[model samples]
Structures are given as C-alpha cells and as structure tokens.
Target: MAGYLTTHVLDTARGCPAQGIQIALYRVSGNSHKKIATAETNADGRTDAPILPEGKFAVGTYELIFFCGDYLRATGQTADDPLFLDQVPIRFGVSDGAAHYHVPLLLSPYGYSTYRGS
Candidate 1:
C-alpha cells in the first residue's frame, strides 16, 4: 500500500517527544511563499492531523518549517547561546499521491537530521 505525508519529531537530547513545536506547511505560491496550514506538535511530537489531506496531495514542491526555538525554551532544555535551529525547512517534491511521504526529525539542541521515511 502507499503512504501519505507524515512526520514525527524526537528530541534526541531529552530522549523524548519534541512536543509544542510550531510547524508550518508552505507551498511555493507564485514567486513568493504562502502558508497552506499550521500546527503544533502534540504530546507525541506529531501534528494533530496530517498537514494536508491524502486526496489533496499532488506533485509539487512543499516545505515543512519546524520552529524549535520556543520549544527548547519552554522545556528549559537550553538557554542563551543555545544552538537552536530555527526555521528547519524540509523541502520536498511529491511525485505521486499514491506513495506516502514520511519526513521525521531527529533533533538536538545543536543540530537535527531529517529523511524520507516509510
């Protein structure tokens, strides 16, 4: 079976879900950017719902912007000089709606990593 767009964020430093993180979904609208949707991570470090409906997906470039600064601050994980990675945008293209796009984030106070997942 095919999958749809999904993501999970893990706070590697705290070894738990990166909750309360602000996330934005943007599509290249004209020569500028326009937000399609916005969501905050649930207790499980996942959006309450899919960023976009499964049936609405099409072949196009999209961006997932993860706001980690406030999340780090709220958790008291790091303060001044914290290596917060603001605007962690994962830009990707959807070739087919039939396939799923799982983009998970494994993050620390200093850095983060993301990849296409199943």
Candidate 2:
C-alpha cells in the first residue's frame, strides 16, 4: 500500500493551532473540484487522523481547502475587511506513498505558507 496525504494548519498570527477550522479535500476532475472528504481541525490543529489512509492514497493531483475566514473569526483574528484569500487552497501532487508526506500550513489572515513536512 502507498502512503496518504494529510495537512496541519497553524494560525501564525495567533501562534496556535487553527482549531475548529473547516477543511476539505478534493481531487481535481475535468473542470471542477470533486469533493472527497470534509473535516475540521482539532485542538491540536490537525485532523483526527490521516486525511487519507495508505490503501486510499493515489498518485495524482489533490487540493486542500482551508477555511481561514471561519478560523480567524473563531479565534478573533479577522482583519478589518477580512482577507481576500479567505479560503486557501494548496494544490499538490502525491507521487509516492512509501514515505510519509506531511504538509503543514502556516497561515495568517492575509497570507499563508505551505511545505512538505515529515
């Protein structure tokens, strides 16, 4: 079996896990995004488990939708006019599963960053 795709979101401005943030995993279909799974972050700012398990991992393109608007609002960190990028989408590819692929997002109300983690 191959590995899976997962992500953790951190509210960089608040310096904490982005708890209760809405998240969605989607696979890009022809012209639209196909929703696969929807979940929320826990107290630790991570999904309760791997977003996708070993047997479920696939070698293709994937996108993670993070609802920063709700996260910031819930955490009392929303900007004056909110952020233009309320929904941050990170599109990436999963080529191999033998290794663990952890993607972490460090985000703020106005900007965010993502990288391949352990």
Candidate 3:
C-alpha cells in the first residue's frame, strides 16, 4: 500500500480534542519551503482527509505547522498578550513511500509534544 500523511491535535490542558486549529504542510528542500496542503482540525481534532495523500507521497523532509494561538484564546486557555507557545512546527522526514505516517500533537497553553504515532 502507498503511504500518506495524517495528523491530529489534542488539547492536553483541556483534556479534549483541539478543534478548529489550522494546520499547514510544507515540503522543505534546503532553504526553500513550499506549502503543499492545509487543513483545519474538526471536532475530532483531525483533518477530514490526509494532508498529503498517497498519490502525493514523497520521501524527504517536511514540516507541519499548527496554528494554536486562536484556539487557545477561543478556549480561554491563554490570557497573555502573546503566548509562549503559539505556532508549533514539527519537522520530520519520510524515508519510505510505502508506510503510513501519523504525526500527532499533544498541546497545552505553554508546551507541546509530538511523535511518530500510529
């Protein structure tokens, strides 16, 4: 089977899925960054479809930027003028074109974490 890219965001501080967070996917080559896909998390904290679907799968470095600032303010999780953690970017590589890639974000008002999830 061919591979694709998927992701989700969980609001750790609120103990629930982070809805309406905007996410952008980009292909990174040296000093060049090209945006390839974008989506907003739904009520389930996930995009309705794969950010990078199978036909567009590639083997190289990529970045997923999670726009969390608005979500924080909407959910009343932040009161600072500028949040310590706002736009979270996770950079990773896909060496295999035939494997699934799941990058999930566990987030809070002050911190965030990610992993190669299934």
Best by lDDT: 3
For model 3 the local lDDT of residue 68 reads 97
Off by over 4 Å in 1: 1-3, 29-31, 81-83
**All models, RMSD in angstroms:** 2.1, 1.6, 0.5
State model 1's lDDT: 0.81
Can you list the residue pairs that collide in candidate 1? Answer: 3-100, 4-100
Write model 3 residue lDDT over 1-118, tens digit each, in one string. Answer: 9999999999999899999999999999999999999999999999999999999998999999999999999999889987888899999999999899999999999999999998
- Model 3 ranges off by over 4 Å: none
TM-score for candidate 3, residues paired by index: 0.98
TM-score of each: 0.87, 0.90, 0.98
Q: Scored by CA lDDT, what does every candidate get?
A: 0.81, 0.82, 0.96
Task: List candidate 2 segments past 4 Å from native.
Answer: none
Candidate 1 at 60: error in angstroms? 0.7
Residue 20, model 1: lDDT of: 87
Count of backbone clashes for each model? 2, 1, 0
